[model samples]
Target chain A: MVNAVTTGADAKVSVRNLEIAYGDATALSGVDLDIRENEIFGVIGPANAGKTSFLKALNRMDMFNPEMKVGGDIHFSGRNTRGLRNVYALRRRIGVVFPLPVGLPMNVYDNVALAPRLGGQRNRAELDVIVERCLRRAALWDEVKDRLDTLGSLLSGGQQQRLTIARALSQQPEVLMLDEFSIAVDPVTTMRIEDVLKQLREEMTIILVTNLVQQARRLADRTAFFLDGRCVEIGVTEDLFTGEVRDQRTRDYVEGRFG
Target chain B: MSRSSVTDFDRRNRDWYIDRLVQAVVFIGGISAIVFIIGIFVFITREGFSFIATEFDVSGFFLSQNWRPTSESNPTYGILALVAGTASVTGLAMLVAIPFSLGAAIFIAEFATGRVREVLKILVELLAAIPSVVWGFIGLSIMNPLIIEWFNVPVGLNVLNAGIILGLMAAPIMTSIAEDALKAVPDRYREAAEAMGATRWQVIAKVVLPAAKNGLLGAVLLGVGRGFGETMAVLMATGHSVNIPTSIFDSVRALTATIAAELGETAVGSPHYQALFTIGIFLFAITFVINLTADLIVRGIRNK
Candidate 1:
């Protein structure tokens, strides 16, 4: 356990003593954190620092891998995730965006409409409204409105990344988790998506896992520094940079001395 | 010194000679397939030519059911009944094979894992390796008695018995190919769909199946080809009666069986022998078309 500043009552997600392992190799362990509701929580770490593994554990993705073992408790809202009978219902409330854009092998309209359809929304008019609003919120509607029937994979890399954001938003989730969302986007597109994330913070709690240290500074209300499979420090985003940090490693990593 | 080094580098070694020899051997092996196919086609054409050019009546050969090649007087070679028998049996075989193989493929590819998956894969391969004659034997000894007892049909060996045997025979290979097709779909697509909260069934139905449709179609066509080309099982199980089948219980004859059964007894230059060769040509063309179509459909996935 690391950060004890936030209480469990206000936290959107409370994870305690979480551990993840694949076969014999442990990827992450002893992680404790509280993500407040409607706050942009940034997680910064280098490659293989278990940032991606942490997000995967949040949604119980270990079920797909027979060799992956997960232990300890993760509470979403107030209910314990491990005790839930239907994992699909739990996943529906938490949206995820991968590092590289995954524009499902479908048309743009259908891609954005997939999650809602999975949830049993069959009305065409309702689907149309949801698709438009999600795409618009991701800043992609105007660019793709004329050619909604084209394959989503045919779009430019930057556009596809935005399209992925639109797809994640389509679920209308309570928590939106993005893993290195801007790794494949241009600087300008990255800034544009950053603005969209800032706006999204008002509606949902956003967990942004980023490699860019400055990105955490720009948007996160509070940030947690992960190092070598452990959460090193958690504090106000500005305080971590300007004020004193408890761990020297957090300052060294944030200052770009070493990963 | 620089010139000497360049000359040494350019000199061919023993490895280069071995490489050339292996390439030449593989080239001959590759080209022999076309050579043998053409050779077989020419020989069959020559053997069947006299009957085709002289006595072959287009309408009677295709539309009439009479195949009395052994008659002392009228010796007609109409094969309508044979065509119908082959068509019916193959059609029924496909009906049984498609679902069984596709379901097995879905289980092996999507559901089964670790030791279970490995065991299932080996079992399927073993099933594919079983001799057609053994399947024919089972149809003769086992399925024949079972079908007669269950359905109370007069004939034990008939279209249904042969069709079921052929379908079971075709399923393992079809399952193997369909599994390969399903496996070809990238894991990322599955991961993405799973992350979106789609249930296991929903992920397969909505994403995986649509992506693998072409390959699945190819697998079915290959099974149809196998059913068409199969002879020993059809001969032993179908009772080899020369008739146009009306129902599943009706015993029937197939084109390949006719060639295999009669070619041994007919005199070399007799019209009876030539007529059998004509049936051979027809069987060859149909199987060729089916196999080529399967190949093309499977290739379509790679291009995309």
Candidate 2:
């Protein structure tokens, strides 16, 4: 297994030789990755490319499903995350936004404050700060602040997605992963979300999965293209987009010859 | 031209297909059943509503403490005691059944392991299959004696006995329906909760339960309605008292039992007969209201 540990480097996430299997099929095999603090990293791939699986393995969300099997080392802030048995603590450090806008049945305020409250922040003042601050960070506070008590499901689709992002941000996680967050929203909302992602990367390490190449080109500092569960190529976003003449597969994908 | 030309035998053969025949039968059968159920309700309301008056001294008849419908000069028919008794006992049964059923449902849905959960689910289904009459028999033969002797209760056949039997009957239904509700919750919601660093129990209590609240409320309302309308078990174990139930251990009569018991003995056109018919109407109306409330709760949950 490959191990890359740099001294004095404040990498928020360092995953080495990470392997994940679902029942008999191997979803990810011996993947090594690193995410520096305040950098937006995007995973670009077609369907069944193990992008979601890798994201899930980062926060140990797959453990809840009975059919998943995971292996290998994941390190967060110098601690081996594989040895971290507490899924709750692991999740607290790394927040995740699912593909669908799964707004809880509760009010918008509760949806954002749920993580903080579960993490033991109970006072009203602190909750109000977190809810407003996170919603503002998601760029949704102006629209939803007045109607905080309204049910989350009552919100429009784009607002619901932003609310979900705000909910994830309320945890104040060290790293945030979004799994195809813009697939369901309109083009204008997607651009707005991309803007929010750019702002969020200044404070939190962000890993995003998207099929849209331009979204990755716009927001991601580094982009990794995956072809059939393997990382095809990863480099600076501009290099991958402009000077990617080495890998023909990446070239084919970028040129839209084949996905 | 062949015998099976495109416009001739082929079209006739296509019309005789099994799928079309089956679809026709299913459509007709479903509509027929719906019509039959509506017809039953209409017939019951038509027959029962004729004897009911718009206004009367129902306060005395319903709110009275005693029910003595006799053939004497003053025929006393007070259903208030029975209605009150049914309400109290059914309320107690709901309180007992809800927690136990919800707890068991949460366990089966979220916590229980493979074989254990399957076994528990089967046992719950078995509990539902046990007839209400059998539950009454068990209440009489086993439950009542145990409550009286071991628990040192005053009497065997009382509101407590009926409540216990009704609670037992309602538990399985509530648990099964609540389990289905909990199961209906998409896995993504639970994952989202867990990813928020929520413990398993916390996920169940906070996220899962709130999401399935509508279904759970529906289950509870259904259980309450079932307990309210239960005739056989309440008739058997409630000791058939006409007095208002003073306590859990007091004997009482329910509206269903009152109708069941007096229908055969009373004269068809007498005031007593008419009052019993009115009691039938009242029972129907009470259950209808409870069911309507349950429907509203389910709809409210959906709106949420």
Q: Top TM-score: which candidate number?
A: 1
B1-94, model 2: which lDDT tens digit per residue? 5865557744656557887899999999999998996886776555545455533375776677657778476666667788888987798899
Model 1 per-residue lDDT tens digits across residues B1-62: 46656677777999999999999999999999999999999999899999999988889898
Docking quality level of the chain pair in candidate 1: medium
Reference contacts reproduced by model 1 = 0.62
A1-259: candidate 1 lDDT, tens digit per residue: 2243433888899998989898899888899889999999999988888899999999999888988888888888867788788999888888898889888878999989999999999999999999999999999999999999999889998899999899889999999999999989999989989999999999999999999999999999999988878888889999888858999888888899997
Error of 2 at A235 (Å): 2.3
* Interface root mean square deviation per prediction: 0.7, 0.9
In model 1, where do residues sit more than 4 Å from their true spots?
A1-7, B1-4
**Candidate 2 lDDT over residue span A131-171, tens digit each:** 99999988899999899999997999999999999999998
> Roughly what TM-score does model 2 have, to 2 decimal places?
0.91
Provide the TM-score, chain A, model 2.
Answer: 0.94
TM-scores of chain A, one for each prediction: 0.96, 0.94
Report how far residue A219 has shifted in candidate 1, in Å: 2.2
- Global CA lDDT computed for model 1: 0.91
